[model samples]
Target chain A: MAEREINIEDITKIEGHANLLIKIENDELKEVRLGVHEGKRFFEKFMVGRSYKKIPEMAGRICGICTVAHEIAAARAVENALSVKVPECVEMARNMMLISSHIQSHLLHLCFLALPDYVGKDNSLEMDVETLKKIYKVKEAANRMTEIIGGRAVHPCDVVVGGFSREIGREDAERYGKLIKEAMPILEEIASVFLTLDYPDIRRQNNFASLYGDEFSLYRGMIKTSKYVFEEGEYEKYIEERSIDYSNANRVFVRGEDFMVGALARLNFNEIDGRAKEMMNEHGIKFPSNNSCHMNIAQALEMVYFAEKAMEIADEFNGCSERGEVKNENGEGVAIIEAPRGLLLHHYVIEKGKVRYANIITPTAMNLESMERDLRWHVEKILNRDDEEIKKEAEKLIRAYDPCISCSVHVARVV
Target chain B: MKIGVFSLTCCEGCSVQFLNIESDILKLVEKFDIKNFRLIKERNEMPVDIAFVEGFPSNDEEVEKLSYIRENSKILVSMGACASNAGIPGMVNYAGKKAKGIKEYVDVDYFLYGCPFSIDELMELISCIFHGKEFRNKNQNVCSECYLRGVDCLLDKHILCMGGVARAGCNAVCPYNGHECSACRGGYEGIDIKSHARLLLSKGFSEEEIIDAYEMYMHEYVEELKKWLKER
Candidate 1:
């Protein structure tokens, strides 16, 4: 056997940092190693000695891509710590903010991150000028929605512990409603395009986890996996974190086995409603696919579902009798929201009206092991392929997860 | 050719920024062997030629990890604000007497400054290493590289900026963008807190408003600023 070594340092175009190492024998891949060199922020430690009221604001800094998830989870946690029951108006408003985030996040991921891989471009910037214009249109819609709700794309400061710092007036919601209504057709088109894209043929059967609801609904549900419905405080009972030597973030296993979250997981669970099911059926997507690569289609499908849900929620809030307000006190609480990626959990302990401790479990952390599993499967299956081909194939598998470690680490980047 | 990258206690944005570099990063991967990285896979244990360490030493485990990296690797680069002057995480030093035992925190060698170190800086640092160049500390403040084109200070307009007292390298992004500086880069060694506060007051800002702005934006140093105000 003849062995040759070629080093691949920083693999880009995906979220966070990663490196690829391919070892070949006779021009066939024998072993592949992915080295992700991203740093970890010990947010749990940072939460200590900080005022509980500020946890949501601080945690909101986690990731620009999924700031709403962080803010919502932190707010829920802090509210729980103080044992304060937030008003229904606040809940509805919070849900609206989350829905807005979902819309923008899914749009950004689908158009900017995941689509470029299928479109054979390095980044959205590399897309054909005409196609790039279309992508920008989608981005503009997402940006418009984000501004209407959270204030900006990166670190939105409007969300507070019990409620939002600023209320979206009837006029604001109406403006958002118009943008969301316009975005629906574009989302439908994107979903259709995703359905037509050429996806990898690799199939790996993995259990899925997500907040439960019908396809068209974004609010209200416990985390639903195939075998269990774990309520908010019961999250730890279902999902356990194991220490790993490679990454600072722990490898999460559901019920003593590896599971996936995000697009593939959401689709596999199939807890969505009739309308979403009809849409998926129309697109020829059969649920519980062993071929996780089809998760991108699921993501696109969810965007449509989420957009419709956002419109519904916005409409409902517009009809509500009361405005939103923040309730204060100290206690412990937990919240899990479905971010664009998957289930995002924020747990907090509050003392004297400040956050005592905070723990965040992002979808990417949950899918880390699953990502490695898919990578190994792809590498082994393509062991006979050329080194360059193997590298490209492996990268596609990683991107399929759309991992958001910045959310897991609870930080933001300008870019 | 093996590389090990680890983060202590700080925002992970610098690493994410590296990922944002895209194609240049892919080219770097085509050159070097990566033995261990936490953000990529679950496998661990490999010999490394270069160790990129981010974050500050917070506790015993972090200290142990930093020491391990220093002992094992031929080159150790402290790559972000946390690694340099403890960055934002080091702000725990201002949490009153309760945080006075910070020296008991962690041990480290080498320091890189920046709230989250810039990707361009990381690339340059790597280039300097490959070319056998010595590492040099950047002593400038964020205002030095700020893209503001030398507009009059916002502080001159009664807005508080840690830019004068904070270390540089963020290119003054916050202030240049019309937002007040948060001093996320950490404090400068020779900053005179008394005079800085007095300058803001002289600019027609109230003492309470100045303190509020500082505490709101740069919460980490609130205790020290309060102590300085008491003396004045």
Candidate 2:
């Protein structure tokens, strides 16, 4: 029997660096190791001794992709610590900002990032000229929405500690509403395009986790699993994170087993409520999808759901006269917002009107275990393939999660 | 040529910027042999010709990785603000009341200056390496470029700008775009801290506000500014 050692020292096109090591014996994979070579940022250490007021600003620097989520989560946590109540209008605006992020980020991931994989393109640029144009249309719509609400697509600077530093006026709000309304048809079209792609036929029967509530929401939700739904505070009990020997990002398990979140999880949960069911059915995505590989389809479906949800949220604020405000001297706070990736939870301990301690749980961290599980499954199936084929499949498997490793402030794309 | 790219402690935007280059990236993929790139797919170990490293060395593990890359690669290029002046993560050094900084806290090598590393600049560096041209280490402040381009000084307008103290090569992006300098770019070499602070103070800004603004993002510089002020 012949033996070969296959190693990918760096994987590119994804965020952060990960090493893939596979030992092939007689063209069969014997052992596989997915090593995240980067070190973790000691954000927990950095948070100590800083005034609570600066938590949002400081934490916002964590990940450029999801800065708004961090900002809102940190600010909400601080407000809770100080026992302050934000105004209703302020809450609505905050919700609008967060929802806009979900719309922008999810669209980018579905069309620009993940779609290229299923379409057999290296990147969005490599897609067919016509398909590339459609992708750009979606990109433009996302960018327009992000600018109108978050102030920029990458790291939005509009969100401040107590609330938004600036408010979107009626005219701007109306313009934003118009943009979402105009983009809705395009978004649906993009979803339809995703429905046409040939997705990898892989499914997992693992548990699903996401923050679920009324009407396409990213903010204010309880942890909803296939088995149960619990309030935001109960996440600590349901989702467990353990430090792994190899990765800085902790492995997450729900009820003592690896679970999945983000697009697939959200879609699965939404299907139970008849949300986007027709679209799912139209796209041939069935609920209780056992294959994690189908996450790409879920991502596309969620894009349509998020766009419509954004339009509905914008319509509600269009005619509202008053915003929300919260005032409190000192108290603890916790905020959970579903980022484009998955559930993001921010907890703050405040004292003397300052943040004492902060705990931030990002979506990628929550999905790490699911990634490992999928990798194991993939490796098991493709162990007999050539090295190049094995490496290609491995990357596709990981990209399915759309892992945003930079959310923790310490990593970058894998190359 | 085999090239290795790594990140230490950063927002990872610099790497994202490289990915954002779109078509250019595919060309790069065809040109260079990637030996140890973690942002993409995993690969086997091979000899490296050039190493592009982003972010700051925040801990012992990072220290080891940096040393390994430096030892293995023929040329090492520090790729972003974090790798340069410790970036925002360096701000953590200002936590204590007494004077201790990130440099005193973490070990790093060489420097590339940008809040997020510029793809155009990186491409230039890579091209220079391909032609066997030595990459020049930037020793100038970001203000030089801002002044050379006749860009308006934010300090003159009572708006906060760190260009006076920040390292250069970004071409003053934030200031040129009508935004205040957030100092995502790291600090400069031979910065005249006293003069910069005094200039802001003379412009009707309060001392507390100046200190607050400076300390807000790059706290490591605050103690140095305080020491310089004390000497004055």
DockQ score for model 1? 0.09
- Please give the fraction of native interface contacts (Cα pairs under 8 Å between A and B) kept by each candidate: 0.07, 0.32
lDDT of 1 by residue, A283-386 (tens): 77787786767777888777777677777767776533343334555667787877778888888766665566667788887887887777777777776666
B219 Cα displacement, candidate 2 (Å): 4.7
Candidate 2 local Cα displacement, residue B51, angstroms: 9.7
The best candidate by lDDT is 2
> How far off is residue B222 in model 1, in Å?
4.6
Please, what are the lDDT tens digits per residue for candidate 2 over residues B1-232? 8877666656666654554454455567678866665554233364577777777665566667677777787777776666666655665542232222224443433345565666567777778777877766566777787888787777777766667776677776556544456666556657776887888778887666667557644666788777766676
C-alpha RMSD between model 2 and the true structure = 6.4
lDDT tens digits by residue: candidate 1, B50-99: 87776555445556767777778877766655555554334333223222
Model 2 residue A2 distance off true place after TM-score fit, in angstroms: 6.4
Question: Which digits, one per residue and each the tens of the lDDT, describe model 2 over residues A103-129?
Answer: 656665676556655666555544566
